[model samples]
Target: TQLLEQSPQFLSIQEGENLTVYCNSSSVFSSLQWYRQEPGEGPVLLVTVVTGGEVKKLKRLTFQFGDARKDSSLHITAAQTGDTGLYLCADLTTSGTYKYIFGTGTRLKVLA
Candidate 1:
């Protein structure tokens, strides 16, 4: 069974702080996506990395895909209260069971 596991299920930080979250899996993925969701709203795609050793950035956020294609990471620089939300990582599985398997999730609280 393919599964995506995320580290630091919860995080609390003050404004301007830096934080990093990790997503890991034993199985390789064709593509991986990161999303951020706010209360009562659907998740918004933050980044999608397909190739090994690929990296992408969005403003203060950075995303990296592992060379093995089985892991990924997200780093946030100068976090603000506006960054408070749930971060989710998803990997496409080949089993045809589900299109993607989402991480348990990370709840972030950025204090202003």
Candidate 2:
């Protein structure tokens, strides 16, 4: 089973608000990826962190990987209603099938 854990099971905020989501695990991962899933559709990859202490940004979103490679976070600045969805973090394992075990997921709703 996937060992990743995500905090803030649900969130609701104003359109201009800021929010942060966390993903943690006891097991270290070779690579970690973040995805956003809208209703009735599969998740779309947001960012991928391969090295420890790595940080990547996409527009108003920032993603970081912990120094131990067992934790990660996603921070959104000036959130919009378009950001409403389920945010998932995934760990890339060595199972040779490129399998992804997703986090518990954070369901976010941004009100206009």
Candidate 3:
């Protein structure tokens, strides 16, 4: 079975603080994506880094794909209340059935 593990299942921080979340797996993936979901809404794609050691930045959020394609990380600089949400990492797999394996989501709360 393919699985992704994420750290810091929950986080709370004051506005303008920095935080980092990690996703790891024992299996290699062809691609990995990061998403942020707001209350009652589906996750919106934050970024997708397909190349190993690749990094992409969206405003204050930065995403990185591990060189081995088995892990990823998300870093937020100067986080704001608007950054509060559930962050998830997913990887597509073809183990019996083609599907995506999601990490144990991380809930972030940024206080104003």
Candidate 4:
């Protein structure tokens, strides 16, 4: 089984501040993804990184995949209250069943 580790399990910041979260694993994956979620709802996909060293941006958010494909990071610039939620990283495991494993998760609270 592949194990994923995420840093800074939680964050609380004022609007207009910035933060970064990370996900890492010992096993390499073919692709990696980031998601944002609100209470009582399923997570929404933010970005999928297929290539090592690839970076994708959406508004004030940026995502990056490690060169070894075993890690990823998400950076949020000038966060807004609307950005408060749960952030997650997911990757497919080598299990023949193709199981998807999610990271420990980062809970962000952006204060107004």
Candidate 5:
């Protein structure tokens, strides 16, 4: 079974602080993707990093895929209270069902 575990599962940070969240798996990922979900909403696709050692930045958020393809990371710079949400990492299933395997998720609370 393939599972992605995110470290520091819960984080509380003040505004303007930077933080990094990690996602790791025992098996190689097919498509390493990152997502964020606000309360009462579905997860939003943030980025899909396919190449090893690839880094993508969206505003103050940075997403990186591991060189070994077994891990990923999300870095948020200058976090704001609006950035508070549930952060998740996911990958597509190899079974051809197009199903997504998601991590347990990291709940981030950014205080103003």
Candidate 6:
């Protein structure tokens, strides 16, 4: 079994400020998915980066995979005040036995 630990459990920044959230693990995995979860709602998958130097971007957010496939990061640029709720990262492995894990989650509060 493996665990995904997210850093900066809470974030508070101005609307124009930029920030980065990280989800790290000690064990390697197959794929890592980044999710954005709003209050009273299920997590929405932003992007998934397969093992290697793959990167995916959506609007103001960019997701990157570690070269070793054991870690991932999410960068938000020019964040807006409306960016509320929380963000979570999950990983899946398809070797030996299937495993799925979710990060502790990072709550973001963008101030106007």
Candidate 5 Cα outliers beyond 4 Å, as residue runs: none
Local lDDT at 39 for model 2: 100
Estimate TM-scores for all models: 0.95, 0.94, 0.95, 0.96, 0.96, 0.91
Tell me the spans in candidate 1 whose CA falls farther than 4 Å from its real position: none
Model 2 CA deviation exceeding 4 Å by range: 95-97
Model 6 pairs whose backbones collide = none
Candidate 6 worst ten-residue window by lDDT: 92-101
Q: Which is the better candidate, 2 or 4, if ranked by lDDT?
A: 2
Model 1 alpha-carbon miss at residue 77, Å: 0.5
lDDT of 6 by residue, 31-52 (tens): 7888889888899888888857
Candidate with more favorable, higher TM-score: 4 or 6: 4
**CA shift of 12, model 3, Å:** 0.4
* 2 versus 3: better TM-score goes to: 3
Model 4 CA deviation exceeding 4 Å by range: none
> All candidates' lDDT scores?
0.91, 0.93, 0.91, 0.91, 0.93, 0.86
Candidate 3 — what's its lDDT? 0.91
Write one digit per residue (lDDT tens) for candidate 3, span 1-112.
8888998899999999999999998798767989899999999988888999999999999898889988889999999999999999988787787787788999999999
Q: Residue 77 deviation, candidate 5, in Å?
A: 0.5
Q: What is candidate 2's lDDT per residue for 5-107, written digit by digit as tens?
A: 8999999999999999999986998789999999999999999999999999999999999999989999999999999999999887877687878899999
* Model 6 stretches with alpha carbons more than 4 Å out: 94-99
- Tens digits of per-residue lDDT for model 4 on 11-104? 9999999999999997996679888999999999998889999999999999989899998999999999999999999997768887788999
Model 2 C-alpha lDDT versus the unseen true structure: 0.93
**Backbone clashes per model, in order?**
0, 0, 0, 0, 0, 0
